[model samples]
Target: MGNDGGSIPDRRDLVRTKAKAEQADKANQTRARWFFCALSKRRLEEPIVACPLGRLFNKDALLEFLLDRASYGADGAAVAGHIRSLKDVKELKLTANPATKGKGKGRGEGENEETPKFVCPLTFKEMNGAQPFAYLAPCGCVFSLSGLKSLSSAKEKEPGKEGSTTPEKDEEQLELCPQCGAKYSKSTDIIPLNPSPDDESLLRARMEAKRAAEPKKSKKRKAADPESSDPPKKKKSSPTAAPTVNPNIAATSRAVVTSLALEEAKRKAGMSDAVKSLYGDPSKPKQKETFTTMGTFTRYA
Candidate 1:
């Protein structure tokens, strides 16, 4: 089959490059991760927060996710199941990209509309999730690694204008942000953004250490007012008189009473004669009937 009307295979059909396919896949993944929020699937916005797994999310979206997990549907649980609270994420403080032309700023020339929102303030370089970027812990200002290194070198070479300030003092002292003038510990405060595995570990350890140094919250509760808390004394249920019994309601049946009396007599009958005489026998006892109704009988007669 010559390259006639029968078949005309294009370069794309002939060449199936594995490397190209892989690269495309990687680019797609990168765009998915860096350009959109992991939870909400919206365009990435600043005050961005990243989880331990390095998934980026908008701060508000993350807060929403944390507040109500069911809001984002089934994918919410799958994506943010690890994120129990805000503590699980690190809020990124981004530097404004100076090269980024605002609306109606640069309509002509080489202005890219899809430029990154945040960039290294020092280098004037776009972050774009590819470059090695870092932030000052104290001031939360961000800069490119190369820019920071260059700045650090320049600061080292520059002679201390004041007599008191020395090179050794500069090395030992805190790094002040050129943009914000915020002080940060040079050794510990420069945390790399979206760092590699090892760098992430170190950053996490530093974060934990910094948190440990902070004062712990008091667990003890404040005491309420004594007057408000104390309950009123209840009157000693004035020794309730043994619930008054109803005279009309017989406590025991007549037959039951008689049987009880007969049982008592039988018990007393078993006693010795001498003891019985001392205790007195009720059956043998006889006495004349006496009446105390003297006024009623005299009046009637």
Candidate 2:
């Protein structure tokens, strides 16, 4: 067909247009692939300690034996080396998959997207960071100590400067967990960043309260006389009247009493004579025994 000015384009023109479109599409695909590869490669190269997975990898083990301990924290080189070690172990299947693959819309999607176990409690980020403490991995999630005390104080409603005493003006002052966004009270028990004044104050208050609760010693009382002590006193019994006796029995008793009195008088006389001889005084008044009763005496011719 001859070239009609407004007619449909020839087969060659259509072919050219299709070719250019395909080239453009191929370029876009290449760009996207490079972008994804760079991003993935960067993530793979990032320090494991900076990622939540670092907690599982054993930082001390890696540091003491594998990497330098002094250079472990905040060291880009050490972090990179640690990450490479992890990648090698994972690729070799030395370390089993710590995370379970989540279900996806398609078969490959599940394998591509795996969710990690044991998320960071502080950051709620992908648990990427150094072990024990979360740090930002190149993967974007991190556990940070920066502003941790401030963050905690904010949650406790006591936000202030490093040493300032300003109470938390509002709840917004505290830093919420980036993951679960849970709030914590200001204390060392919650956050390990730095010592909080609230914790110190609480400790001091507890000590004071304990001291106040303790029992006190009482003052001593004066001693009292032994005679006037609380124990009861004994009473003396009065003398009883002499009993009446039969004539025979009275007579016999009188005879026995007379003999006993005579013997006793002899003993007293001897002792008195000895005492008089020693002192050279014979007429001294003799000691008398007081009598409780008197009996009738009988005389024989």
Candidate 3:
């Protein structure tokens, strides 16, 4: 009778409903990612920075965590361990939302504190974790993905535009930031802020690729710079002797050093008993350096 008319709910059905109720609300989690510091869980303030994985954080909070990772408890390393230093993050340049500019709510004003403080300059869309947003690496200017895509498509629509030979090369196209006139490479310079896990993997791949290319570039620079090509030579000077002309060093420096050294030797050689007691005899020659005593300090014989 219960199976035919559902007079009583089964224990399995009850458990399933309970499990569904216990599931985490993803909307609040998404909002928290956009509005709070990833490390401190504090409301994000100015001078906000984003890591390569697209997690947001307050710069000060991240700095404190980097200074003493253990201070934030056992979870500190898990939160911001990727950020070894301030250089690991990019300071985001966010556009302030105009809607709440003059109407800033104070204590007891009944205005929701959850109101977004930033907006996309191109689309005027609030950056409340609803729309996908990205920042230009070259300029650090933030914008909504929709706004940026629309602008790019419109710009590329130009008839007979240079570098638009094929529509398939859209990702490789270059575009100027709408908020700032800085030119950014579409394929590389646009970094999504608070990107999803799938998108983060893609960003991570690009980051590693760029870093892999860096050493190659440094090697080329070292090869190109003639001075850096040769290893540095150690300057060797004898206390009693003058240095000969050295092409690697300036003649003036060598002459000054030689004159100073000669004067010191002469003065020491002429020292009286009282003054000479502390110094080694200048007339006697030092023993030749042996393999065993090569680095040992020697006295005049």
Candidate 4:
């Protein structure tokens, strides 16, 4: 068994290809991110969405993944754990790649025939995660930065019935999306795709300012005090005195009053002496209770 075309290779004898392996791994990762959905491991398709972490996804595929996370296997949680709902990722408005004739499969026989799925609708530039792109926050229409600038420049040069517009007017005006014609404030609506640190800071500041500008709900007022605010209504005096009763009627009224008084007196007479004492006669003097113990204790003893 001594070196018979087989020998136990020592660690030093083996080739140290760690650097090549790392490079290959990096290349594969880049390709995967650009060409495949990060969540589904399928070919990227519109409407594509990107998370805050810059991972790409197909919108429908992401939804499916969200609805049933177990369907994508154990790696699903690791890949799309951050996306709890639709708000976690922005739905990308992709510009169709004009160079891409059709959706051709990209493996095995026709690997070279595969074309980009989308491009900047303005300059017809390819959007394969390499170029600088932007989207309108209001309409979500994606375009290359250069293409957008060109379009803006063209707009500025276009003569209106009045004449060429001023730069100040341009800053104040709203920009309409070419794709959807949605009106968006140019100052705040343009959001860069895969924004840099500075761009993200500016976006955050803009968002804060927008939120601050919104009017807060005022507290509901308590019910009004109707009595306090209103003046007391003056009661009207009678026009004439009440007519005097006939002698016969007056006599009958007096008789009824006398009978009621007599009944009340009879009721009082039947009441207990203790109850009667509560309403004692005013003419009677209250009896003074003398303490006789001092005199009686010595004298009587």
Candidate 5:
């Protein structure tokens, strides 16, 4: 008959399964031990401690654990040391999550609510109470909201009380220039008033009399001097016979002859010496010899 019980596994398979389960259990216990150690020794100052078998353990489980410890009266140096130990364990990473770090109160907090006392505006230094006043702008003025309101009320009350006793002078303060409606300060420049309209005619007459008393400038001469004049003069007649050529015409003809003579001389100089010798002397006259041509009729012989 077939066996009623299922067949048992070989030793190797059984040992492998047992080893995996034990490893999982050991990992779970290690995590539990770390958590328990963190919670139990809340007041321990050591950042890392050795167990009996020489295994190292992190005194802090996470960054938040260290931060909470710091907030609840632990010294900053102690908290920082524990955080460094947790990083050495390799199970906890030392990193910044902008969401969890700083004054942020992590996931469950309301968005619009004010941050807790751990955050300060002036230095961003964590604190547990009202922060001290620190000036943050170039104006250098520092005052709480209540102080500013008191100053404004005092200024408004001062002008009214002082104006009633000197009504005439107060009216002048209200008389702003039409061009610039700003209130006149002590630094404003004041011009003297013009005379009243009743004396307008007298003022005009005095101005006219002043103008008549002033000397007038002399007029400048426009005509030329008579002695130094050089108008068209008549040429004197000569006792000798007048030249056939008018003097002006003769002068123009001489200029033309000079230019022609210079151009001919230049042309002769430009010729080769051999070619110039063939043409004979240019400055003196040369006799001309004529050559005659004969015409004849010829028959093919």
Candidate 6:
């Protein structure tokens, strides 16, 4: 429709224009996760350790966070407070990428950067968190999950190999590490790096259950280690224990006790006969209430 004495308004002209905000760059986000400490946000360096949640951190940064949690502020505590000690994290045995090793390193340089600091020896894929990665608990060797499966599949394909036969469901089947040839259990050793929230919860539950099942030697450790053990309890002496003798006295303890009894008797014997009569003879049975009755003290009306 034509506007009276004016140009017809187009849909674009009618709608108010709004500037769209730029979203975060995916490449930068990926690089931040793969190359920086999740806690300290500094460039990742050795000796690096990964949490049960799969996030990576510098060992020194974790130590500092543990030592003074308040310094990192609230977010740091929430990010790493789950890490109570060094035992909570395992040091990763990472293979340096040969492509990047020979080149000089510079901080904050863009694609000008040569390569990812580390890579999977099996697939040669850079550990940039683009794909799944895992580390073995026993050997601490890291490898991409796809590479591990490929190696496993390759073994199974070998003719007459035991892996080619039916797999065993043994609770503790020891598998050799492809990288180091170290023995590890497949069911428990393979820990995913930087796992998703759901996977992290499962890993955390498994960790807690395993720890709870573990034979707690902390009580024993405290008892055995002198520095950690409580001070030895002292033996309590009885009140009637062997009479103590004055160090300056030449007489024995028994002699001192005997002398004290004799003196007490003599002092009583020296009491006047009238004063002594107030107390009846010890040989006679004591009256129920010579001076006062224990009950019914109110006088009869």
Give the TM-score of each candidate.
0.53, 0.19, 0.63, 0.49, 0.16, 0.63
Clashes of each: 0, 12, 0, 0, 0, 1
The full ranking of all candidates by TM-score, starting with the best, is 3, 6, 1, 4, 2, 5
Model 6 lDDT tens row, 199-296: 88988898877765552467356554653433331112222232333433546666888898796577558756543443434443343245443132
Sliding window of 10 residues with minimal summed lDDT for model 1: 215-224
User: Which ranges in model 5 have alpha carbons more than 4 Å from their true place?
Assistant: 1-6, 32-301
At residue 171, candidate 4 shows an lDDT of 77
Instruction: Give the alpha carbon lDDT tens digit for every residue of 80-171 in model 4.
Output: 77566876667877866654555343344355324566788878888665677777766667788888888877887778642466788787
lDDT of 5 at 96: 27
List candidate 2 segments past 4 Å from native.
1-118, 122-153, 156-301
Query: lDDT per residue, candidate 3, 139-161, as tens digits?
Result: 78889999999988777886655
Q: Report model 5's TM-score to 2 decimal places.
A: 0.16
> Which one wins by TM-score: 1 or 5?
1
In model 4, residue pairs whose N, Cα or C atoms come closer than 3 Å (at least 3 residues apart or on different chains), thus clashing, are none
C-alpha lDDT values of all predictions? 0.67, 0.36, 0.76, 0.66, 0.35, 0.73
Candidate 3, residue 1: the lDDT equals 32
Candidate 2 lDDT, 1-301, residue by residue in tens: 3557777788998899999999999755433322121112222222222211222233334434345545444443433333434322211011112343233334364453333323444444332222233322222233445434345545456443433534544332443445445443322113221113564355446434533454221111112222234221211111121222355578889999999889656645755564434333445323212122111111110
Better lDDT candidate (5, 6): 6
* Residue 172 shift from truth in candidate 6, angstroms: 3.2
lDDT of 5 by residue, 1-301 (tens): 1344676667888799999999989755543432223334332223433221112234553444455655434534332333333322222111122333544655455541232222222233322113221111112122222333343345345766564646445434533221224333211112111112443344345434533443221111112222123221112223222453466578788888888778657756775664354343454223111111111101110
Point out the higher-scoring one by lDDT: 4 or 5: 4
| Root-mean-square deviation per candidate | 14.1, 30.3, 12.6, 15.3, 36.5, 10.0
Question: Residue pairs in steric clash, candidate 6?
Answer: 54-194
